[model samples]
Target: MHPALLEIARLGLHALPRASAGALRRYLETARPRLDLPPGEEIELFAPGARAVLARAFADIHHWLGQVSGRVPFFADIAQIAVPRPIPELAAAAAALPLLRADAPGHLADEAALAFLDRLAL
Candidate 1:
């Protein structure tokens, strides 16, 4: 990682209140695309039930923004994870606020679909 980005990840983001981190996480998710399928492939990828799960999550972004919130509990099931860096499954969810804020077409819909089982519990 770039020293500057690492430093900011530590100092810049860490300098803020806990609420800031929470808000930033939420905003990053909102910026991301809800799924990974191509525009025309949504039908093949997400069944009506699965799409509803994401719709609900999108509708409730403000209430559960962070990956850890369990509002979309499926996101928490990273295939593999360790300290500092997130697992590959959550790479997009790992984006920071500035990048996500500027991204017009973010990618993470697969993650949402993976979490659809949990959506029923919401």
Candidate 2:
């Protein structure tokens, strides 16, 4: 991971609600690949190009998260898990909502995910 991304992830942990932070830490610990190969061997599997692509995607997601952090009251829900939609689409939907109340329904996340899909087609 890029150093900047690592820093963002570290800082982001501090910003999360306690339960959400703990859940993310636990998930990272348990989701590690069980590769038996030596340290260098595992690193060799990923080409530099592939690593760059992954890093770009990670950065995009983090950027989108930052963009919506203040706007979405239930950001922790989306932050804790990866949404399937593209970041651009997610961002457009989030930007469309004038305000998302703290007590908003969980399904609003879904609605936001689809908000910009059609717009992107234009």
RMSD of each: 19.1, 20.3
Instruction: Specify the poorest-scoring 10-residue window by lDDT in model 2.
Output: 35-44
Which residues of candidate 2, in runs, are more than 4 Å off? 1-9, 34-122
Clashing pairs in 1: 34-109, 35-109
lDDT of 1 by residue, 4-105 (tens): 123223432444455544443343335434323122211122332554555555544534555456565444542221122322212322233234323422
Residue-level lDDT of model 2, residues 62-121, one tens digit each, is: 667767775433344543233232223223323322222221232223332223222222
RMSD of 2: 20.3
lDDT of 1: 0.34
Candidate 1's error at 61, in angstroms?
A: 39
Off by over 4 Å in 1: 1-13, 34-122
The C-alpha local distance difference test score for the whole of candidate 2 amounts to 0.35
Clashes of each: 2, 0
